[model samples]
Target: MFDIDRWREIFQSINKNRLRSILSGFTVAFAILLFTLLFGIVSGLSNSFKSAFADDAQNAMFVRVWQTSKPYKGLQTGRTIQLKNDDFNYVKDEYESKIQYQSARIYKNFTLKYKNEANSYSVRAVHPDHQFLEKTMIDEGRYLNEKDLQEKSKVIVIGRLIKADLFGEKPALGKRINVNGSSYLVIGIFSDEGGDNEERLAYIPVTTAQMIYGNNDYISQINLGYNPDLNLDEAISFGKQLERDLRFKLNIHPDDQSALSVRNMAEANKNVGSFMAILYAIVILVGSGTLIAGIIGISNIMIFVIKERTKEFGIRKALGAQPLSIVWMVVQESVFITTIAGYLGLSLGTYLLSLIGDSLEEDYFIKDPSVSTGIVVGATVVLILSGLIAGYIPAKRAANIKPIEALRAD
Candidate 1:
């Protein structure tokens, strides 16, 4: 299959129109470069979204109570609805099999002190299961245990950033810190989540929080995780039923429109999916435009080359060269130039993507932009196809020319 004569003729033809060949190659190279960059950016956006959402509890739902915005069921408007321990227990009992984890939270903003070092911080009182609901991982020591909750132990788990700020690389285990003038033992440090403000907070058992903060009768929010096998509609239906039961048991009107709010992770995922879909569409459109332009440029340049070599092609045909050979000669030239230039462009784009991918730090978008192996192979295939297609028409035109007429034309 090694045809030295054919390769030599192809090289001679390209050398005869070196500048035009290079220009044609540049067009294909630029197209591939644009396509690669756009694909990488889209991939980065997808990766960033995944990273941002990975820490969140899967299939989770949140519930909150607020002042009634509308009067219903004989209750006057403006009545405030609040959740209590009874309501949390009722929901758990009703949906025990369907629920994976559940927790109630009481938040307080207070000043924490250790000797002379003091800082204003937020504290959360949560159940042991709250760790699962929040997908929090312990970096050091241990998280609150059931015994801590049952006995109302004055133990606390600080976020990594909080630990760094308050203790500064020093081991913080067994250390005592004052929270709102109440002494609590630091038992554990949470893993860092990369610039999350939540990393600056501290967590304590629900009972200890109620004892010290005296908010046992009130909870600011409730978080629940459900089995992923259930559809969103089924989970939401179950969640709404629980919400109604809680409202009724707590003396809140069932028809109170704004007294209770329920949110599911499914809706959040749908929104994210829509955003990614639109972004991918835009990237494909831009990349396709560049590719088409390059293909057209290649077609025009091949046509020009055919016109310039009309006499030579006629002479070869007159000497018994086959029409397929003539077509292969032109196509080989196109493929060689485009492949070499396109590869260079692809390499450059890949290098740039790798260099900048890790440096991106935007919130929930554009992280780790890099080309995958499949994408590289697909782009190469497109370039090869473009080369053959661009040369086809010009090759046909050259093959149809009569030797006598081509020789006679000035």
Candidate 2:
């Protein structure tokens, strides 16, 4: 019920032993603070890992060629390996069912001129599906279509930063820009989550680059996204199979990674997912240990406090106080201390995480450290329950003591 007198007694008792109460409360607070910080930092690490792959489609794979590092079939080391339109056609024909989206890329650097404004930017000649593989978002107009690739159209799509630099408040769409002296129409402007370097690029049709740059059918790399219906293991197996087949077709040694390599997003994603799961499990174990230690510390303090007040409890019993009243008072005090202290710890930890923000992203790969609302609520419940248990045990034992024996306690 509404027992103001009981509350007054509890408050008076707490005031009488301020040092003991502070010490108990501090133990709980520090444990909760440590728990919060640990979880928040791990969550930040998870965020960093996710953002690292945000630039590309989860199922994307890349096939790259470079100079041979090992001799194979009488061919000497250091021979430059090259990918061509025929190789791209071979992949498309061989894995038509397994492929979702495919693109051939040819890298170039061109000085783009829009009237007086001019700057050098990285250019990629690619197929239409390159947009999805790169996760490029078109802000205006449209990306390259099959018609552009077939017609070898002199149409280009520029990045958001490129548009801003060359156009500067002017509409870049439908405007003609000179690229290495040749005029090309800007069909679209796009942005990428891959950061500034990605946003400063321009893309044209791969066929156009092949026709104009070298008058030959040469490509720098091939990118493809596996069918989303395939599971991770299946996707990985597909990538390996494709890689081995490509090595055989290109006359490169099976172990010669420098000659030809396939980079599979599926393998990277699986490894990262496993790593994060293990990390979270470890953090949860450590956090639970901290909470248990806090509970034990408070329990010990309560036992000591009850022992010290045994004589007082005996006097109250001699004066006709109920055992229930004694237990209730002690439990109330414990709960009060734990609740307030836990709240303070939670608040302080969250504030510290907010202050951390993205400051650790560059060096530690920790981004936007934080704990979830459900976790906070769960922690609060645990603290309250622990307080109740801590108080109940010692209070029960003290209440049961005979008045004479309790009175004799020193």
Most accurate candidate by lDDT? 2
Q: Write the per-residue lDDT of candidate 1 for residues 1-410, one digit (tens) a residue.
A: 98998889888878888888888788878877877888888888878877776767758788888898776677778888777887788788888898888888888887888877789898989888888877788988998889998999999999888887788878888999988888999999997453567788889988887776764567788888887778766776777777787677766776775788777776677677788899878878887787777777778888888888888888988999888888888888777777887898899889888877766644435788989999889878977987788788888888888888877756
> What TM-score would candidate 2 get against the native?
0.87
Candidate 1: regions farther than 4 A off: 1-11, 40-55, 194-196, 215-217, 230-257, 307-327, 341-374, 392-410
TM-score of 1: 0.80
Candidate maximizing TM-score: 2
Over 1-410, each residue of candidate 2 has an lDDT whose tens digit, in order, gives 88999788777877887888788888788877888898899889888887888889999999999999999999999999999899999999999999999999999999999989999999999999999999999999999999998899999999999999998998999999999999999999999999999999999999999999999999999999999999999999999999999999999999998889899999998998898889889877886777667777767777877888999999999999899988887888788878888888888989999887768776788988899999888988987897898788887887788899988888
User: Relative to the true structure, how large is the alpha-carbon lDDT of every model?
Assistant: 0.82, 0.90
RMSD of each: 4.1, 3.1
Quality of model 2 by C-alpha lDDT: 0.90
Residues forming the 10-long window of minimal summed lDDT in candidate 2: 290-299
